[model samples]
Target: MNDLTLSSLTGRTVLVTGATSGIGYETARLLAERGATVLLHGRTDGEARAAADRMIATAGVNGERLCTYGADFALLDEVHALAARVNANHPRLDVLVNNAGTAAPERHTLTADGNEIAFQVNFLAHYLLTHLLEAALTSDPGGRVVNVSSSMHRTGAIQWNDPQRARRYSRVAAYAQSQLALTVFAADPRVTAVSVHPGVCDTAMLPLYAHEGCAPAEGAAHLVRLCDPATEIVNGAYYDRDQRVEPAPRATDERTVKRLNKLADAAVGVGS
Candidate 1:
């Protein structure tokens, strides 16, 4: 094990979603290198398995010790099944990095679940996953949930009357709304959650907005820092890159949090 990773992450188990590419991919590799048992997730079996293989080889861990899981975040059923699988197999999870996201900057689309695709993929799936796996996380003495939000959410607001954006929608609005909701969800008192803006990294999603920013490694570094057990970030706070920042006023509003919780509970059929 690399000395740094070995010291900070050895014996810890971390699950990073969207680990097949971009910041997620780099974050998984870094965690694996540091000696954490990393569960890599993707929307496809082949890509996730391949990522697992690379991590095993790179980290010099036994192939049998590394694992991968798949689920299409666009589908809530798949998200539930994923949570069940992880909860069943890994009873103790020290960290969960909800880094998966989508960008449909041109238009709005709906998932089979009737929720906006970006809303479901970027926010709802992760919200449900974290809720279902709360036990696994809380079982550990020092557990953390890192939600990958974005600075773009600064201008976003959830449409209370049209949460699905069925009346009218744009990719930008949907994406930002989803991100803001996610940051709000992270405020759940049941878990020690930290939401982050991984910076505008050069990734596949960048082209959706025709923007370029930092390297994926640089973006992943911020996530890795938050995941570090020794870091001093306040639970339920938001960060831009590594610096904590105030989210949009709507995100901090008390009513905003409650309304989001109610909607999420209904969307995932949690309390029903």
Candidate 2:
């Protein structure tokens, strides 16, 4: 044990993906500073290892709680493996955070999994990860899945006709669609889920932003609260900063959420 004790999270465990930087990083750091054993995710070994080191070096926790996993969210197989690794060690997960995301630059880039890059990384990856971990989450008193999303979700909707973006993909459009789906996923009650906008934090992704203002730490505060069990009623909502905002009409559909979850399962090969 160390000098700092986040006794508030004395026995809880949280997994944060894309945690090497920005909002995800800040959230993981705060959780570690307290008492929650946080699992941080990065897409590369170097990034993952570096993030874990930084969390430890910076947080100064009692036990070694912050560790990193290198899984590219753009690939389904990798997500499955990432889930397996987490499940192998933790019997039940108190918190599962889907915080990794990216925006493509003006071009259509396909990932190794043969799907649009933005779609796969932002939505599909989180979808598979959450489904695979549902058993772990639901097995608990009532686990939470904090799907890191953005206010941009209001700018787009799910293409019930073709979610894969088979016709044409724009960077903004693709990313927005994924986030919208994330918002929908978070609303499901089988396992508590909520999508959060990290309040325009000063993370690396800011370069991708058309507008600016919010800092990452400020945005992460809401995410931290969402992780707390006391805030159970906030489930299935999209958090813009600290307050919950309504998702688009498409995001509020049970059939759409279920359909998207099914597509995600087929892509990653799993079930609800």
Candidate 3:
């Protein structure tokens, strides 16, 4: 780990999705503590605004330095709308932390958009958001797209024929697939993307998928480390518990990236 600490974030701007609670909330809170102008996102406007206000009251971070945006990730149209709003207002974003994800334990659920719920919320939504914000990210050569993936992705695979797991559904398979997709997309050379396995933290998701781990603050620290400008992590690399490691073989395959990109483009109504 580098010496670049949260204090180094002074004056930078970061947008964190799912900042309402869990790791996302901790990450956003710490970043704001570091003096970054942070934009918090939640599934609804009230949720996001309330979260930002709470941060101000609890952390003493200036209200002007922190704001909120809302969008339901399970819907493609809402994702697009959120991106447009961000671009229209804040044209310069130094870092993007895609910390939002879902874990549905027992059932196979479909989004209103007709896509698998996990796939849409965890991976596809972030994919669309990243592309839409490419301009702002690339504007500063030091900008980064930090994707919160998981070590479980090592067992993940792209269901090429059934990208949405339409044929059959397994909670484990869907969650793993979504994480793998995020890692694969992070490997794209056009932008500075970093994938992170934030560890199994004790959060609301724990009951849904039980595992022993640290608190949200500890997990958020791993993300903060990656966001540190002085940290010399190679772009498009995967980090497991703050240490860079090779992801699953499929995540590094060129063919896998291409196929997934194509499918994602089609799914989001964007051209390949």
TM-score of each: 0.92, 0.90, 0.95
Question: Candidate 2 — worst ten consecutive residues by lDDT sum?
Answer: 1-10
Local accuracy by lDDT, each model: 0.84, 0.78, 0.85
Clashes of 3: 0
TM-score of 1: 0.92
lDDT of each residue in 1-272, candidate 2, tens digit only: 12123337758899998888888888888787767888888998689888878666666754487767889887788888888998898867899989898875577787888777887888888888887887777445547888888888889877767777778677788888878888888877666777888667677667556567576766677788888776654667777766777767778788887887777667666666
Pairs in clash, predicted candidate 3: none
Q: Write the per-residue lDDT of candidate 3 for residues 1-272, one digit (tens) a residue.
A: 33435246787889999999989998998888777888899999999999988888887877877879999999889999999999988889999999898994568888988889999999999998998988877445558999999887888887888887888889989988998999998887767888999888998767544667689888898998887676666777999877888888888788887888889988888875
The TM-score, computed over Cα atoms with residue i paired to residue i, of candidate 3 is 0.95
Clashes of each: 1, 8, 0
Regions of model 3 farther than 4 Å from truth:
1-6, 208-211
Root-mean-square deviation of Cα positions for candidate 3 versus the true structure, in angstroms: 1.7
Candidate 1 residues lying further than 4 Å off, grouped into runs, are: 1-6, 57-65, 139-141, 208-210
Better of 1 and 3 by TM-score: 3
The residue-by-residue lDDT of candidate 1 on 28-62, one tens digit each, is 88777666788899998788998888767765655
Error of 1 at 12 (Å): 0.6
